[model samples]
Target: MDETASPVESADCRAISEVLSRVGDKWTMQVVVTLSDGPRRFNDLKRRVEGISQQMLTRTLKALERDGMVKRTVCATTPPQVEYDLTALGRSLAEPARRLAQWVRGHLGIIHANRRQYDSRR
Candidate 1:
């Protein structure tokens, strides 16, 4: 009898890849990081995340909600208040994102120096 098993695709692998694709988007990580702090209103998020247009923010938040990383709540008020908060799974990513942010902060000088050197050569 043959002992070796054939290489095969698996459902788990596809699911994980799909999830990574969603979270790996440019705005997704930033949005996740922003919401990790606490619940925030739509306008507040747009204001806090620099360079994000209102449409882009709305789309990113909707995608996060579809991915089960964010929870949107509507509060009863005169104009209807909406807020976003991270789900448990989303909150779990805080440590990793924090580490990434810290690493970026630490290495930004090197990055800027490299950019300056590269741009000067161009």
Candidate 2:
């Protein structure tokens, strides 16, 4: 067998890979960014993360909670309310997430042009 090293094949960075499996997902990334500002009720979060299905939101939040990146709290009220917020661990990802958003904003034009160029040849 060949022993070439892949970025995620290393034992030391395995934890990061697992984390990425959650945060790297599209919906999770949006949810994290939305909650970065503050806690949001379930419906409010759903509204902020446009196009996300209810099932997908539930699943993503559940996975984030399982990973210790999100905290869920149920409010005591007439109808009851549930909110989600980033935990300390989740807050740690804020800078990286912001950087990622910035990178996308900075590179989107270039990426779109590149895609157009590539598509012209096809």
Candidate 3:
């Protein structure tokens, strides 16, 4: 907390920080973007996400579900089938996430060059 900051500002900052910590996570962003298309089964999502392990996918879905950003449904079948979809809140986040991804893609070359330059200087 800054010496001159009011309590309300501090509380707001804390709230923003907490939300950002979740939303800014790489897996969370990727999962949200993937689910933006529509609902997907566990194995399908795992395949589409690429590189994410089954355990990590499970954890990410659980976290999103807990945050009210995703809905999980279990279908009736011989073997229960589970699907994950974005909630309204998750859908709301999709646009901004897409924009951020676009921005990152646009800047990736420059970012890599900057990183390389900085690393070489060190």
Name the runs in model 1 displaced over 4 angstroms.
1-13, 112-122
Residues 1-29, model 3: lDDT tens digits:
79799999999999999989999988899
Cα lDDT tens digits, model 2, 1-122, are 12676755675467777777777899988998899999999999999999999999999999999989899999998799898999999888866988999999999999999999999999
Worst 10 residues of 1 by lDDT: 1-10
- Best candidate (score: TM-score): 3
Instruction: Score residue 84 of candidate 2 by CA lDDT.
Output: 94
Candidate number with greatest lDDT: 3
Residue pairs in candidate 3 whose N, alpha carbon or C atoms collide under 3 angstroms: none
Candidate 3 Cα RMSD (Å): 1.1
Badly placed stretches (over 4 Å) of model 2 are: 1-15
Order of candidates by lDDT, top first? 3, 2, 1
TM-score of each: 0.78, 0.86, 0.94
Q: Evaluate all candidate structures by whole-model CA lDDT and list the values in order.
A: 0.87, 0.89, 0.94
* lDDT tens readout by residue for model 1, 10-119: 55566778888887777888888998889999999998888999999999999888878899999999899999999998888766877888999999999999999999
